[model samples]
Target: MSNIIKTIDVTDSLENLKDVCDIENGRIAGKIFYDQAIYEQELEKIFARCWLFVAHESQIPNTGDYVTTTMGEDEVIVIRQKDGGIKVFLNACPHRGNKVCFAESGTTRGFICNYHGWSFNVQGNLVGQHESGIYEASDFDKAKWGLKEVAQVDSWKGLVFATFDPQAPTLQEYLGPMTWYLDALFDNQEGGTEFVGGCIRSTYDCNWKIAAENFVGDILHAGWTHDSAARAMLGGSVAKVSDFEESYSVNWNGHGYEFALDTVGNVAVLGESALNKYLHTIKPSVAERLGEFRSNMIGAVSSCTIFPNFSFLAGQNTVRVWQPRGPNKIELFTWVVVNKSAPQEIKEKWRKGAMMTFSPTGVFEMDDGENWEYCTKTAKGRVTAAQDLYIGLGMNSRASDTSLPGNVFKGQLNEANARAYYQQWFDHLNAKSWKELPNRNFGKQEAE
Candidate 1:
């Protein structure tokens, strides 16, 4: 254990506003960039307690269809039962703790443990126990031994999520004001957005937060970090002060905001002419159906991090599951969320757009990889790792908004959303349950 980690005062290291807030500062203080100890606590406090995305409803549409993955460190299998409801359970066997299902994902009428032949149905009910003669009914309570269920499982739009903490709030309550914005993106559509296909899986050598933060708040990197790639794709140089508009929003359970430039507008300026022509041709049709804003974003970049770990980038049309492998490593599950009923041609277009923007070989993805690597490298240094990180962007810019809850700023690029995320993160780290959060702010904002 001694060789396993180093500890830093997160509270103290998080104090210095200027240095912490400056992107340049984050570039400098490298310790927190990738620390194992910080990652461990994140699993217990953040991933375990918060609502981590599991799979989209589209992934498991029919009864008994399932997908296996991890929520924090606990392996989980989410299945669509016969009744059309969703259930999430530990993918472990009740008998000997062996993994019950080894396949990554598939439809299953039920599962039987390979080690002991203990069988369980999709509902997680233990149907049979091997060697039943020796052990009486009293030996194992089938009722008590049903595969351990996740504490809470819920869906927002078509996205499914699970929590390990029994006291965690329902998905809607936890999303807070962000729900309104999410609805605009996901629900306002014809049938809500469904995932395009199976996820795009990859791994990163940096802290999970690096990916999360970059997805949600780091819109400043596109033009430069991706400069060469952008030029190659567009056949021209990226504009120095690219007119990309950015914004941020915050929710109670650390949910964060992102506002991005319109896809057609930005892509036309920075992408190939052929791609731009295709986008322009399809623009009118999409705008006619989904309306101008969303249709305009058919390939535009929009994104948000719903606290803890679920992040989606709209411009890229990629929904990401940042599963913490540890403090310094994370497994990325990237899925393209689209309307299940979209025209086959449109779906194909969306797929192509996703491939060009966020796929493993995408230019944007390559740019991010470079930065994520550098961010993680800093933590290996002894002298630089001790400095505090910052979130003080547009500190004075925060103002209460009647249009939106929490706090809102006129322009989107401010760090108020990031600060709000940390505030909620601190709350979760300290509180044992959701019951504590309301008392802390139960009616303070409403009372005011």
Candidate 2:
């Protein structure tokens, strides 16, 4: 076996991706995020191989309840069975390779293969052979055949995850320093966050990475992108500060983000006065449940990603599952998350806030859709695809902030976050597995 993870030549189809850090001169000239070859490689090197976010534990609340999800392109069935624990299995039937269950989500005692009548239990066991008499004389061991289980599965803060690579680190370890930051959004409440409603599934005519990068890199666009909407609703929203542009830190493993303005509209689902009052009213309770800093950030909008595929706009309270449908097309699955323990009125307020700001009809979403669509159109051009893009902002970055979660940029508009994201993208693209990557890649604090 080759000791080093072999990498696709940076000069091949990815000829434009020249270096790990390239935010100087404000230039990011590459199609690495939207390339066909890179997308396929990600499915193998990153998606198929990494621990992917599958579903929230609450999605399967009762015995035999289940939901169909995806890890990269592989379909998985996550269910709550008799043992009162979550179980996940490849959605493919053991017989004839057909998908056993076709529903997007539901509760089930187990799945019966519609193709051949092979029944599998919630734990993915071949509990019943439809016709045992025909196979009684056969040498097949019933125990040997079960729905193919993902290599590894686990949860953190009630979020379900699974990995195709058996050797990848645990989800906590994989998340590294990001866990500390994520706790602000996911673990703040005593009961934690849960999906208020089912996810909204939509199709986008764009590359999956474009959506991923936008979450981390498009802080500059918020003010202008949603100017009309913000003006109509916010009427001089506080995020006008975000229009000034800023830079963010790059983290090891490429899980990073740019810190933008902290706005009331960005945080609590209620009005600014209501949100602020709630924080003050709940200060004692908030502190008792969550630390002071995390409590304060409850309503703050943060643009962040946990490397690989999971990306979220905390300010908007939207969790996006960017599932790739093809090289140039992607299925955008969005979920609204709210503190489960909050009062009915507060939950409803947050639901309204999330729907108006991030949903398919939200003004901010429509504003961004135009830009993303235009970019996608430009990427298809033979000339434009060959031309490189730029991401060099604050190239010789001169700031260090240990207290912050990841790398720190000099200003909010700096492209540091985008560079950090792409750097890790390159690292994953080049390395085959966690073990194959060099020790220094994760940096000291993040690696541990």
Best by lDDT: 2
Please give, for residues 47-69, the per-residue lDDT of candidate 2 as tens digits.
86667888888888898888888
lDDT by residue (tens digit), candidate 1, 200-281: 8888777776777765555567656777777776676554433555433443445665554364434443344554565567
TM-score of 2: 0.88
Pick by TM-score: which candidate is best? Answer: 2
Model 1: number of backbone collisions:
13
lDDT on C-alpha atoms for all candidate structures:
0.66, 0.67
TM-scores of all candidate predictions against the true structure: 0.83, 0.88
Where in model 2 is the C-alpha error above 4 Å? 1-30, 242-250, 260-265, 268-276, 287-290, 439-443, 446-448
